[model samples]
Target: MDLQQMRYVVAVAETNSFTRAAERCLVVQSALSHQIARLERELGARLFERTSRRVRLTPAGMAFLPAARQCLDAAERAAAEVAAAVGEVRGRLAVGLIPTVAAADIPGALLGYRRKYPHVRISLRVGASEDLVEQVKQGSLDVAFLGLPPTMRPEGVAAHELARDRLVAVVAPDHPLADEPAVSLRRLSSETFVDFPAGTAGRIQSDLAFSAAGLSRDVAFEVTTADYVTRLVGPGLGVAMLPSAFAPQLTGVVTIEVTDAPTRVEYIIWSRFGHTPAAAAFLKALDIT
Candidate 1:
């Protein structure tokens, strides 16, 4: 019924444990439980189903959660706006990025943003492209960096296109294909591959390219992080196709230009409604708008 009660509910839902939620909110478990119980009584609905081992949101809780999150966001945005009026940007900035983000220098950008806006608190998460986009749209993240096939664009949000590049094949130094300056999707398709899991945005770019060429790849190793792919390929276990911008950063792999490769477009996305003061300044710091 109140913001504090809603915060407790949100925390409990996210952490999936009353004890952990209490720790996150810097309160004791009993007080947090009492507040949520009081709120549930006021709302005439049970928000969570509790058990000895686990906590799960009830139907009513799931229904209440989105509005509760929006209310919280509104309250935070109001305070941020007041600070903005005084030419100060002090608030939480939650940023999400794909691990292979190449269009912008993420760590360097955060360093500069921190130096310029010392009052703001910042947090970062690395996730899949689609997951980051959804987090930005859901109000969990203020901004995100994403990369997808050039044919697609993030829907229902405001995004700035950062750059685009074709993917390159990476192989070990003594691998048969390593000496080649250039290869084709078809050529790479014949080798064992290490790649992101199937159906992920990063994985799909290569999947579609080979599918279109009427070829199939043998993805022997499925790993989430690009660094893992590099490690796998470094031992001559399998080959990987990575973004041109990203491939040069690795030391063990030899980058061979793919004659016919999938093109990926990088973007910076934020809410379409408006930017929070911290997000606005951060984007502006990068000359995005």
Candidate 2:
């Protein structure tokens, strides 16, 4: 009738003695007898034939015994699986990153995270900040690295400022301004600019910088990735602004500090859905405040 009743029946069938089976089940013999009597009465069939000397299974008991054992076995396995999922520290986690962060310095952080948490599998996806933020909000990603403007937090998501990287002017080595220690926004205002796409964090930063300097920027091309923007600048496609951390790795492009640009805050974002241990561990590797 119920799992406990089924367990009693199976235990009695195995031990073939009410006294000993109740001992194995940790119930008094009389309590065991009452439970089995209730089960047999509900089924309207005798489960065991009893004698003064011993107990033996009835034909119905022989047919039902294996099924009862199988049910208990399945319930046990389900409980164990649920416990493992709740308490164990191993599973797959999906992470997203804006192209700028992935290009600037994520590999070393990820390598350290993987070394410490070897059991956790991690997959990396790269996209624009807007796309990665949407992925985290929609639960398609466990966490993401993105640049955050001062007032753009979405509901049901939490973000922490992980690091800040400075934006600087990027130009081909042969460009006249490339030799300067710093480039003023006024001097570069009319130059063709390779810009980040609209609605992205980098583009917003560029817009703010131009606004601060009272200059209007001329857009030559729109790009989605920092690496591509730097590469394009090297070929004289246009001048660009990029995070200074990308300077050492970029070939043929010279980066000069933008005298008036503001520092951008890089963030680690996750849905309110709660971060997995792997994502949390990865955040720790960044040493984020």
Candidate 3:
């Protein structure tokens, strides 16, 4: 099958809806369906089981999916190598950034890269570190800035350390624990806490620290952004544990070091293979080998 047909199949598999897949692929539904039908005819098997309510991949489709992805990846890598040979770094670069770690010169680095390679198109996605890492692993993102706990290591990706920051507790200035030089994890077990959502890197580190101290915290508020957590704590809503880099300078909030808190290591991560020339240029701009 042609690369276009393979792309259509992959899109349909990912979206699980021919109509939505067509929309994503920027083609009409009939055209996409025709391609898939042609592909299935050539293979002599049904790739997807279609129903009124949903679409599911058949056994043949499941078996073909990985090979299809590999083929596409290889084609892209070959194109990138060609572009590199010609000394051209012009292509779409999809990069993911974690909000908590986005402040650590990543934006500046991207700006410089854009200035140096104006023809290169860049798309930036902001999300939780775990989600961003997943995007990188899935090949949707060329690279990602992630905040990882020291105890948690990523697999199947190349991680370059960007920065290391400690986790700290934030509270209202008049709060009972605001004056403390440092707070232990066990001391905040009973405190009402504002925190990042579950499964995020920040939340994972906080959970692990509490669990390690044999203490549990009552998370009264959960937000997706560290800035919002800081704002919430500023209004005396509750205390929060966030990366020290995200500690805000708001009027009512005070940051206290967590004596036993986990270290949040920021990393620039990419897939082990198939990075585009633009991605490599961006990494070079960031001083990553």
Candidate 4:
């Protein structure tokens, strides 16, 4: 019935134990259980199925969970807005970044943000662009820096394009095509390639580029990190197509421009729901608004 009860229910649903939920909410287990029971009675349905080993959410609980989270988020946003009206920026900001993006200016912007709003707590998460975009849409991340192909745009979020870099071909220095000024996709079709795993933005862009060029590569190594791909290329394991910014500076590796390669664009994405004070301040600091 109240926000406190909703918080307790959400906590119990997440932790699956009354004791753990109580610990998370900083309340006594008995009081938390009593509050949840009162809520269930008021709602006329059992929310959680409690057993000796585990607590599972009933259908009612599953249906109510999303709304409860939305209510909590709305409450927080309201508080942040009130603080903002007073020229205050004080709240937690959850930001996500794609690991392969290397915008050197971001660190300086973060430093300026820290100096201007020292009380604002910032948390950073690194992941694939697709994953980070999903987190922003799901309200788990306030904002994110994502690398996506120019043809694609993330849905359900406001995006600001920051920068675009060309995809380049990387190979070992001793390789035949290492000294080339630019390499065509068709020429590398027969060569073994080290690439990012499927479903990532980088891999998706690579696949699209190869398909567009009527070329197919023999991907010999599939790794998660861009650094790993560069390392493998340095050892002559295979050639890789990577964003120019992510190309490594290894002694045995050389990066060549990829002819007709797709441009990887970096975007700053935020939830369509209004920004929190801290998030707004960060956007201002980065001159993104």
* Reference-based TM-score of each model: 0.92, 0.65, 0.80, 0.85
Candidate maximizing lDDT: 1
TM-score, model 4 to reference: 0.85
For model 4, residues 1-289, the per-residue Cα lDDT tens digits are 9999999999999999999999999999999999999999999999999999999899999999999999998887787788888988877788888767765456677777888888777788988899988899898899999888788998889988888898888899899998899988889888999988887887888898889888778987999877788789988989988788777544468989987887888999998877788888888777778
Q: When superposed on Cα atoms, how far off is each prediction in RMSD? A: 1.9, 17.5, 3.4, 2.8
lDDT of 3: 0.85
C-alpha lDDT of residue 100 in model 1: 89
Give me the candidate number with maximum TM-score: 1
Candidates ranked, most accurate by TM-score first: 1, 4, 3, 2
Give per-residue CA lDDT, model 3, range 1-289, as digits (tens).
8999999999999999999999999999999999999999999999999999999899999999988988887787687678779987776689998777744576777788888888777899989887887889888899998888888877679988877888888899889998999988888788999988887777898888888878888998999877788788987899987777766534468989888887778888998865778888888777788
Q: In candidate 4, residue 275 scores what lDDT?
A: 79
Residue-pair clashes per candidate: 0, 0, 0, 0
Better of 2 and 4 by lDDT: 4
User: lDDT ranking from best to worst?
Assistant: 1, 4, 3, 2
Which of the two candidates, 1 or 2, achieves a greater lDDT against the reference? 1
lDDT of 2 by residue, 48-113 (tens): 999999898999999888888768755654554454478644455678887777233667776777
Q: Which segments of candidate 4 are over 4 A away from where they belong?
A: 104-108, 172-182, 228-237, 248-254
Looking at model 4, residue 1 earns an lDDT score of 96
